[model samples]
Target: MCIVYAIDSDWGWYYFGCSTCNKKVFKVGTNVRTLNGQEITSHIWWCEVCKENVSFVSPRFKLHLVVKDDTGEARLMLLDMVASGLISESATELLNGSFDELEDPDELPEAITQIFGKTFTF
Candidate 1:
């Protein structure tokens, strides 16, 4: 069990991952040449490790939390499922909602802010 004292939204808390290999991916645009000598640009989710273009992307969360009890304070990295449970919202929602709004800790969404001062069983 742990109590959440703060959500460190200073860094990006969520990321887009490759659905196939489950690795971090970047949204990128690439130019493609057609057989007819036409050049076309396309946007895709690219995984450098996988070295391929992926159609499906899954949301992943990597959150830094400040949690404490009577003992002392500690910093924790909560990822994916655990992070979802802490905020009572799935990573997909976080991605779709206000993830882009997280330029600063003070700019965190209410969904994340509501987790402050909340306790849960790990």
Candidate 2:
């Protein structure tokens, strides 16, 4: 067991996961389209491994934290369910809007910071 001494918010604390396969979704490029002789461009989420465009995706936590016991300290990566439980909120809810609103990944939320000094069985 160990205590979460600090959270490594400098890296980022979450991700947007594919709703279907629960895999990470990435935006590769801008998709351009023509309607009524007008052009429009939009960003989209695609799972390369899944080989499909995902219409729906939700945020999932992917946090790296600093934990320590009496002996020493170590870095830990918490993903998905585990991370969600720690914050008692879904990653999507935490985001509150499109991921584009996040100027910096390191600028996370108070819920994540609140985990500091908490103990986990790990």
Candidate 3:
């Protein structure tokens, strides 16, 4: 994972070439709250060295790459606490689809595990 620090408070974001191949990339600020609703600010940095996305928040927080292969696919992920309020390793389910526009922080599918898994980790 690419670990980077916030360089400026004006813009908690950094724009640079992805280390993968000097591709123009950026690391944006992500204010991720913990399981307890504690705001754990961090950034999802596009690794210049590893060429991968990494977290720059509390090392105690547990974050995993959430990949969506479905249509309208965006580089979305599941960010949550490691072990505190919810079980780890779960997937976010579609609350309603095939007709209406989807919103963030949807519900969980059968056999739900973590709260963070559903984008409501904060």
Best TM-score among the predictions, by candidate number: 2
**Candidate 3 residue runs with Cα over 4 Å from true position:** 1-25, 56-122
Error of 1 at 26 (Å): 1.9
Q: Write the per-residue lDDT of candidate 2 for residues 44-68, one digit (tens) a residue.
A: 7899768987767788889898999
Tens digits of lDDT, candidate 3, 1-122: 22211111222111233334434334555557686867665556565566677553121112233323323323322223322233433222222212122232232232232232343322
Q: Model 1: per-residue lDDT, tens digit, 14-91?
A: 777788887888877555657678775544778988999875777788788888988888888887767776676777
Flag clash pairs in model 1. none
CA shift of 67, model 2, Å:
0.3
Error of 1 at 95 (Å): 3.3
The lDDT values for all models are 0.73, 0.81, 0.33
Order candidates by lDDT, high to low. Answer: 2, 1, 3
Clashes of each: 0, 0, 2
Which candidate ranks first by lDDT, i.e. highest? 2
lDDT of 3 at 12: 14
In model 2, which residue pairs have backbone atoms overlapping below 3 Å? none
Q: Would you list the clashing residue pairs of candidate 3?
A: 2-54, 19-48
> Is candidate 1 or 2 superior in lDDT?
2
